[model samples]
Target: MTIISLQHVTKDYGHGRGIFDVSFHVKKGTVYGFLGPNGAGKTTAIRHIMGFSKPQQGIVTVSGLNSWNNASTIQETLGYLPGEVALPEHLTGEQFIQMMMDLRKIKDDTHCKKLMDFFELDASGKVKRMSLGMKRKLAIVTAFMHDPDILVLDEPTSGLDPIMQQRFIDFIKDEKRRGKTILLSSHIFTEVDATCDEISIIKEGHIISSFNKQELLNMTEKVFHLTVENTKDYTQLIQMIESDITFQLISKNEQINELQISCYPSDLSKLIKRIADFPLLSFSEVPFSLEKHFMEFYDRRVGGELPWQ
Candidate 1:
């Protein structure tokens, strides 16, 4: 079942800003990733989903209720960590957690205690004096302490250190195992790649691609960097590829007698045979990376028209 849905949601801020015709759904017990660079309307779209902003056009719903009209109910039930956190500076981290517990009517502090330990957070310091990373941990603890069925996290690991980031990623996997529905917006490809079941890439206020994570994980296409024995081999290789359309040349550097090519596993034998025909030096297959696939949409201008690759 769809736990969260945004249908043709448009919130035009003008001056070429805000989400346009953004449409996607987060199903129950699945982690959905919303990816984009800075100023790409990721936060804008998420705000609509959280009912923090009303869309000028289209519908935003959570659990069959209109998000804008039922904002309070959604906010109360969903565990949300905003991109930009706001905390009461006067309160210590401990006090802040207690305040959130009271607001959520959480009678037990056991889960909260576990969260603090799991994140390795010390809530004794005042919010104003805490380091950015500590504050982030505090936010994460409170946001998830309730263990809500649905979660909306925006740049959830922004201020965390590398170790803490990994911890958060691992926590997300645990949450998925527990059958929590998650909507995550982040620029960190690793987190999305590690945790998301579905993904959407938004750019220039439009969703350029939406796809299943398996599509990326299961991609058979690969890039290989080849170093030939001599200048003669490099020259001949380019001529060989030009004559045969089998191997695609991505780039080359005559200075180092090296070239890059793209091919699938099916063409591995053909590629090896062709390379063996020349004075070979060395070749290595470059592992496919999510950053490369994600950046392909950066230079694109078709808005929401581009299909997922």
Candidate 2:
């Protein structure tokens, strides 16, 4: 079942900014990645979902409860960590944990102690004195310590070191195994690619693409480098070859041609047969990286170009 849904939800900033006609859903027991570059209205959309800000138009609901109107009630089953978390200066890590426990009315301290131990967090230090990474870890512990059914984390690993980041990823996986619903928003592509079940990409305040990992892998092309015996026009050569396969010329110098392309296993034989005509000196196919795909999306948005174009 859908745990959260945003229908025709539009948040206008008057200057023609903010999310426009945005819509998507997060189902129960799944990890949904909320992705886009900075200032792409990801934060705005998140705020709307969390009830920190009301949408200018349309519906935002969590578990069939209106997000804005039923904010407090919806938050009962939700766990959240904002993009820019600011812990109280006067509070120690222990104090902060205790405070959240108090508010949630959690009678037992078992869960809280386990979380701190799992994170190796030192709870005795004041929040103001902790390093940025340590503070982020504390925030994470606080968010998940309660083990809420639904978690909405914004830039959850922004400041952590590599080791800590790995731990956090493991934590996410563990939570998934327990059937927790998660909505993770981050500019870090690999984190999303690694932990999320499906990703929804928003650009210029609009959701442009939503696909699972396998779906994206199927859509993206793997580039190949071909070195030929002679300086021939491989454009028409590869073009005719790709007629039965899938490939495209990325760049060409005198004796070498680089093609950024992809086709299924069903078409691979046809491509190999075509390459046989060129006296193939050396050939190699390189798969697409998650970082490259992310950069492609970011570059398009930065250049103000339509994603589909």
Candidate 3:
């Protein structure tokens, strides 16, 4: 089931700013990753989903209700952590948490306590005195305290330390296990690669690529690194690769007699057979990564064309 959706959403802010023609859906019980660099309108699109800003075109919905019309209900129910957190300086962290609970009319503090303990947050300190990391922990605690079925987290681990970031990732996995639907907007490749079921890459106010995690992992071409035993073998290998239509040479180093190539998984046998003619020092498959795929869109020269495109 589609729990959250943005249909052809556009929010133009002039000067070529803001999200445009952004569309994607977050299915129930799955994590949808919204991947983009800073100033790519990630926050703009998320703001529309949260109903903090209305879309100038198209529809934004959560649980089938129009986000603009049902802002209060959606904001109150969904577990949301904004990209930039702004807390009341006058209130202590505990007081702020209590205030949120009161606003949501939540009577149970069991989950709230667990979140506090899990994040190691000391909410007794005033919000004004807390460091950026502490403030982020507090924000995370409050966001999940209610245990909402749906969550919208923007740059959730921005201010966290490495250890805390891993803890947050683990927490997200636990939430996924409990059947929570999540829309995670982030620039952190590791976190998204670790948790997302589906990923959408946005750039300069536009979505460039949207795909299933497994589908990307199953890309037809696999990259491998090779080191030849001698310069003669390396030179011959390059010549053979140049002549073969199946192999795509990514890079080569003549001095070290090393080369990288991309070949179809189905052509592995053929590749092995051909390479056997050359003296090889070592051969290893370079692990496929989301970062490599992401970089394709990130590169301005590529014009946002996906590998398959």
Model 2: residues with Cα > 4 Å off, grouped in runs: 224-245, 249-261, 269-285, 301-309
- Model 1, residue 77: distance off in Å is 3.8
User: For residue 296, what is the lDDT in candidate 3?
Assistant: 66
lDDT per model, in order? 0.88, 0.81, 0.90
lDDT of 1 at 67: 93
Clash pairs of candidate 3? none
Model 2 alpha-carbon miss at residue 240, Å: 9.1
Stretches of candidate 1 above 4 Å error? 217-220, 227-242, 252-258, 265-283, 302-309
The TM-score measured for candidate 2 stands at 0.83
lDDT of 2 by residue, 132-155 (tens): 988898898888777889999998
Whole-model lDDT, candidate 1? 0.88
Question: Candidate order by TM-score, highest to lowest?
Answer: 3, 1, 2
Candidate 1 C-alpha lDDT tens digits along 143-241: 998988899999998999999999999999999999999999998898998899999998888888888877665555678988898898789998887
For each candidate in turn, the TM-score is 0.86, 0.83, 0.91
Best by lDDT: 3
How many pairs of residues collide in model 1?
Answer: 0
